[model samples]
Target: MQFIDIKAIHAHSAAQIDAAVAQVFEHGRYINGPEVYELEATLGKFLGDSKPLHCIAVASGTMALEVALRALSIGPGDEVITTPFTWISTAETIALVGATPVFADIEPDTYNIDPKEVEKVITPKTKAIIPVDLFGQLPDYTALETIAEKHGLKIIEDAAQSFGAEQNARKAGTFGHVATTSFFPAKPLGGYGDGGAVFTADDQLAEDLRAVTNHGCKERESHYILGTNGRCDSLQAAIIQAKFANFRDAEIALRQKVGARYSEALKDYVTVPKIHPGNTHIYAQYTIRPKNRDSLGEALKAADIPSAVYYRKPLHQQEVFSHLPCAKKSFPHTEQAAQEVISLPFHPYLSEADQARIIATVVKAV
Candidate 1:
């Protein structure tokens, strides 16, 4: 009945996690220990490239985004276009780096930022486009990359929700000028605590990201750029490595299977998730859009089945972004999605009995 079965996930890898943590404790190098580097290397291998992508582990997903912006020198007088339908961190990080966040409407079908809308928002001030991989599926990166190349803009792929996902055989973190993913325990390839990593193929940018995460020092006692304390703890890295062993081997396929079942059973009752061509989804949340979303939620609650909304209000309508021009602009798709989207209880380990119960409740309610 839980929204995400964290306990069940942990139980699946308890012994491996325990051993990893015990090793970290024995070494007592809690910050930036050997395990952190090992995890980063493992991550790089997971998201393969002809030349291995450099992965810089950081304190959290927010830090990874901020570091990416800072390394790219995107600041005041610059604008970053991103979807307003995602978690606040996607846009807020742009604002935090002294850049304006220009809102782009999402595609109703994918609930991902519309590349067409992105093109419309580009002004002289536009420096980068942050395409978020919403609900564990990538946005139209091929189109976005073409746009970025035409305009000479950077693309920062926000893959926090789609770490294990794939598009055209390329992994989630392999797109964009630089990409970032979260390990917030709830993510597909998550750690025991808050953590994230930045990915890039450019050697210089990789070096810059490493420095940015470590007080701007390439070596001890020398500061090259303005930076913050954004280092990931060794303990978190160890936990992620342990879990990743299983996550890559079996958990991703299990998630895909569960997601397919939900879509197959619920498609007639509601708007099930739409998997774009050439993309493989991990279903971080099995979200659906039902006309009577609120009523359906009530019915599920009455039936003792759990459900939740990913975002009840689009970022354009949020009070914090009111001063921005986009805050006043109408985004029909984003607004409609806010009113209709609801996520059912989902996890790789969701029992068949639980899945059936959830589907029956939803079908009846809708």
Candidate 2:
């Protein structure tokens, strides 16, 4: 069994996708075409906002974070606070813009950037906080936002894994000063290829992001500021729009049902994931903590049931960022989680039989 059944997912909407791609070919405007804007609008509405919230399509999730930082003017000599446990892109984007990524410890339960740790790391040089919504759940934004306001820091919600997640009535991509989501095929609302979107309620920042994504020019031959070619192609946008139109809601429901089943069946055998109050988890990866993660992973592999790890090492311990400026202490919780976490085969389209088999294997392995 595969960890993510991409073929099975696309099979459900092949005809609609074909028609969308065919329309894109007929238009022949591959870069920054009509489909890109249509998808931005569609996703903006999907996030439950249109008037105030603006979406800018980018080339990748990393680009979305970079563009958001550029639009916010975070640059060299500036410090951006973030969690130690996440994909490198979360911290890599900060360094890409010549800014320092200050590492913060995470909350053990949610495995997200801890607000208290974030507060402790705040300095005059601190410019922003990029809190990742790890494993398809939104971070503790209530405390994070309050801390940002007190410190005058921008809150950049890294919703790369949480496209369909929600906290209270607000969606994942609708949080903080700006929020970013990925369409890297494995994400909750993913495209066939690399794509991402940046969201913000600030009108000027939204306008700046549009310019930043297209060589810093709103009009032809007119340059205003430094930017990159981060525009999303029409073909990928068409595929994402088609997939989102038909399967987004139903897929979200299926993921919830799947997550619940895993939690119910495996809670006794392993440490299942936890959802924060008022937050709806999308289960991008149904990760659990078995007593012996390595042994459990080996057993699953032996049984032909695939499993993976979101992050085996926290960002602070990574070789690339080891010498970078950070807190002069250890992250006990983040370190412990890196050793214990294991993601089982999880997808919206995973069959009941497959799930049962996975559960039984995990129970026996542990």
Candidate 3:
């Protein structure tokens, strides 16, 4: 009955988590101590990010994006092309770094930024392309990669919702010039507190990020670059390291099974999430597009089942950003999805009986 059964997961790993915390206590390093680099090394090896990659654990996913853009020398007068169908942090990071965020439309089927539409938004000042991996599904990177190469633009993969997902064997963690993720508790590989990391295959960029996140220090008292306090806490690192041990291939396969169950049970009533031919969706949200999204959500709620909307409006329509130059209603698909998308209660721990109840309610309502 829980929207996301974190309690069940905690019950399964309480002992391991306790052991991790105890080790941290024994070391007496409350900040970025041994636990920090330990997690970084493990992640680096697993991500297969060549010699240049130096994972810098940061305060949050938003921090990761901000630092990544800074390392690229992105600033005022620069425009970064991205979709408006995501959390505000995606665009906020761009603006915080003094860059303008240009909006692009998304595909109705995949709910991902359209590569063709992305091309239309490009201009002489375009600096980068941030193709978000929305709702645990990845955009067509193969197409986006080609566009980036042609335009000489940097690519940043917002892998906050997709940490372990793969497309043709290339996982989300390994692609893009810079890939970022959030360890917000709702994410697939989250920790007890806010956590995030920046990944890249550039040695200088990694070193720059390390300095940027720690008061711009090149070393102890040797300030060479401007930076901020963004290191991931030692306690958070320990807990995440322990959690990483439990994350396995079998667990990823289970997500697919759970997604399929939702897809099969509700496709007749709602538009289930679509998966690209070579990509494996990780089911972070298991969102669906329904004709009567609000009424269906009410029906599920009335039955004591939980349902919510992923996004009620695209970013360009929000009050703070209305004045930014954008085509008048050119993003029809993005606008339409805002009114029709609904996220059902989906987690890896979902049961057949619970899913059946939820699906039955949707069928009855629609």
Candidate 4:
């Protein structure tokens, strides 16, 4: 068994994808073409925004975050409040922008950065709050927005794993000043290769992002500002457009159903994820904590059922960030969760039999 059935998904979308590639090859506009625009437009609608939000294509999710911070002029000496219970990319981007990443503790249940803890971490240097939507569930955005307003901080939703997530009747990307999603093959809405986009209600920020993605070029070759080569390739965009055409909603539905089965079957053996009220979980990983994570993962592997960890070390405890104030102090919850959480096989194509086999193996191991 596979960790995620990416091969099965590719098989299902092969014909449509071939056509998309053929069109791109025929046109020879392999840089940025109609396919790129179509992808941006289709995903904007899929995101379901009211005022025609903007989507700026980039090469990767880390590029999106770096550009967003650069657009806001957040750099050295500035701090971004965020939880440590996330992938290193969350803190890595903050540091790469020459800004300090302020650590905040997660709520033990939801594994989301606590807004109250965020408020405490904020100070005069706090320029942004980057609450990650870890494992495809939206964080407490309503509370986050309130905190943002109170502190006069820009909220950038680090939505790398939550492309289809929702909370309190609003989509994940629609919650903050801007949101970023990755198109790495493992994500809910992914591309054939490295791809990403930034979502924003502000038109000016979108324009800036577009230029930033292309070496600060305003047009084909007109340099405007210092920027990186972060443009999304047309081939990747074509694959994304093809995937968006038919399987987007169906895949989301399948994920929800599959996640429910995991919850029902595994709750007795482990601690399932806890989502806040009025929130929708997109089940990107469907991670749970077995008391003996490493042993359980090994047993599952021996049973031909693969399992992995979302993260091994919380950012606060990572050696690279140990000098920062927030990283210096203790974060018990984030530390504990990092050691126990294991992500089992999850994908739209995971069959009921596959799930049953996985569950049986896990129950037996635990």
The numbered model that scores best in lDDT is: 1
The CA root-mean-square deviation of candidate 3, after full C-alpha superposition on the true structure, stands at 1.6
Q: Write the per-residue lDDT of candidate 3 for residues 1-366, one digit (tens) a residue.
A: 877777765665678889999999998998988989988888877787455356888889899888888878898999999998998888988988889999999999999999999999899999999888998879999999999999999999999999878998888766788888888878877788899998877888888888888888977988777677888999999888888866554556767898999898887877899998889998778899888877887788899987778789789888777768873445798989998898888777778898888888888899
Superposed by TM-score, candidate 4 places the C-alpha of residue 308 at a distance from the truth, in angstroms, of 0.2
Candidate 3 has its poorest 10 consecutive residues by lDDT at 245-254
By TM-score, how accurate is candidate 3?
0.96
Better of 2 and 3 by lDDT: 2
**What order do you get sorting by lDDT, best first?**
1, 2, 4, 3
Q: Model 2: how far is 29 from its true place, Å? A: 0.7
Error (Å) of candidate 3 at residue 231 is 1.0
Tell me, what's the RMSD of every candidate? 0.8, 1.1, 1.6, 1.4
Candidate 4 residue spans exceeding 4 A from truth:
220-224
Alpha-carbon runs more than 4 Å astray in model 2:
50-52
Query: Residues 190-210, candidate 1, lDDT per residue (tens digit)?
Result: 787899999999999999999
Per-residue CA lDDT of model 2 for 1-366, tens digit only, reads 789999888987799899999999998999978999999889888775546469899999999999999999999999999999999999999999999999889988889889999999899999999999999999889999999999899999999999888999788898899999899999988888899999988889999999999889899889797799999999999999889965665888898999999999999999999899999999888989889988998999899999899789788888888787564569999999998999988888899999999999999988
* lDDT of candidate 1 at residue 172, scale 0 to 100: 95
Clashing pairs in 3: 212-228
